[model samples]
Target: MASFRKRGCTCEKKKCTCGAKWEYRIKYVDRQTGKTKEKSKGGFTSKKEAQLAAAEEELKINQFGFAENGNEVVLNYFSEWLEVFKKPNVKPITYSVQERNVRLNILPRWGKYRLKDITRTEYQKWINELRDHYSEGTVRRIHSIFSSAIHDAVHEFHIIRENPIQKIKIPKDVENTNRVQYFSKEQLEKFLNSLKTPQKNAKYKHSIQYYVLFSLMARTGIRIGEALALTWDDFNEKEKSISITKTLVYPLNSTPYISTPKSLKSVRIVKLDEQTVKLLKKHKINQNEVILRYKNYKASKDNVMFHQHDGRWLRTNVVREYFKEVCKRTDLPVLSPHALRHSHAVHLLEAGANIKYVSERLGHASTKVTADTYLHITEKIENEALELYSQYIKF
Candidate 1:
């Protein structure tokens, strides 16, 4: 496996630390390049350390059929790995994000360090520096990319024995700093009523279709993407349930495409209130009239519930921009369209819907996620519970 022997040096030279030292050497064949080379290490204080190092190296070589690039600089190696290994295996959206992080953030900062030389302390300092400048979520994402790269180096390339990125202590407060806002019942009614009755000067273009689109998200807590992916086929009129099996994703410069909902639970059936069902009925009749202009496009074939009046898929930004205008007109706090889903969760949970059912309605993979996200509502519910308990205390 590995060879270890005593290496002799002339003690006559004043610069020499010792007359002899432990030496280890091995021959390793390159798996990808198809070449063989001698790998050697020297200058250990004891033979045991030298032998152990050599043994580890030998094991790495044997397992992977090549010598680990432990000596390679971190940047050059990871850049190549990202392009060659990671990009092809992951989805386009994932590849685009990871590639940007690697190229711009990770490599720019740690590209010079050698793989084996990156210590836990060194990474901790780097992370601390990152925390001061970037948001907590961005810093965590960069750390995840670095950790995944090191994990691959260990399992696939046998380059490092451990992942230094994982050992860094993460700041707890640095998680999810996104500003979340939702409407109270009065505010929601005001906003939706503003959409239906536009002021004379503003001339809001909201129709039955936009009204149904926004109402459905508030009613069912479905993501905008999931709502956009719906078709006439997905709605069960008799059962009054909507099938949420797919989502629409539109990346820039690419044709719009339908993909499965984010998780298995995302593909579910959600019952609709009668008012919402009636709204859909009126919207469907209006949509049928609009689709007649597009001779080549089948509205049902396109599988879009809220297809644009011009027979095109509605991009995410289009809906967001329209909602922004509606917010300005309504004299309401400006919130993204996704806030409707959050409002839905908060409203459902406050009305004493079971937590598990709310989780399923939101298509969250777990109730824990639902509980954590709508924690404000849970706190209110806790206070209400205490009031109910007080009724029994007057014995």
Candidate 2:
């Protein structure tokens, strides 16, 4: 309900000659916070005008749950939206990624600005600024998170009329495209061999588990997280396959936990080669001997295939550091553990495997995604296909 009053007049005592404008104040309970808030406008010429304006205000409140008043800060609204919508819907790791980017990128710049005041020109400028400091991929993700929140504000909350960040183009990355993200077959073989062959006078010895882990990743192209989440039950010896149902979500700053795979397709089964199966079988026997050697040692209750000596999920950071060291020792290009996945994809394509088969084997969402990611990496395969096409054509 709204109350109308005359302002700039001494009407409480008696009617005066001074002119005053009519005002109407509507009080509404905010559904998001469960608190009453007031919306008022003054300077109307008459009480009838005030009442008509108040009706519009009341309609917006009733329809949209609250009237924005165009003064709400972006940071406050985004925080509320993140909690109410995104937190429950996304995975913990995904939520953390969104929250971290919002804190580090979005809030630092536009948090103080009112949602109604942010124009498209300003948003595009901010996106360009972000592109200057971060990789195109990183900026794209940050932009996506921010734009998604804005979209929900317009469509779901009616806080804004439209999203200003729509149709914004992400700037190209400045980083070198030629920087190696994966390895050739020979380099992959060398890296794996370094893991298996014992190093003399080494500060720390490489274990058989590390060898099997890399071997599995190279052979099957499973994610590092999926490989870490593997347990004895996930493997089938007779079938020569591994079920990729879950993945490890190990944040660098927090304790590790098991989560579902990256997507629905990521939960599919991955067939293993004979050599990888033999490596895993050998690793299991070695793990059993190690367990017997230490009576007080506590093995991970889940029986994870690759774990710390005390039987805990291995940290990806630690694995990555060791992987880099192995690369340095063997004179190979140091790349992240994910490179094994890329190498596996490239190897399959080079061996004349069907694109659809490789896509399914790698658990990609589609063959297009597979081709887009690995097509550039398979230059040799492309040349060979071109050669074959030229030979067959006669015109």
Best by TM-score: 2
Residue range 359-380, candidate 1, lDDT tens digits = 9999999999887887767878
Candidate 1 local Cα displacement, residue 45, angstroms: 28
The local lDDT score (0 to 100) that residue 305 gets in candidate 2 is 90
C-alpha TM-scores of all predictions = 0.76, 0.82
Q: Which pairs, if any, clash in model 1?
A: none
Per-residue alpha-carbon lDDT of candidate 2 for residues 28-108, written as tens digits (9 for 90 to 100): 887655778887899998889999999987886775563375556777777877786799999999999999999889999
For candidate 2, the 10 contiguous residues with the lowest summed lDDT are 198-207
| Model 1 misplacement above 4 A | 1-36, 39-69, 83-90, 172-179, 198-206, 291-301
lDDT score, candidate 1, position 290 = 54
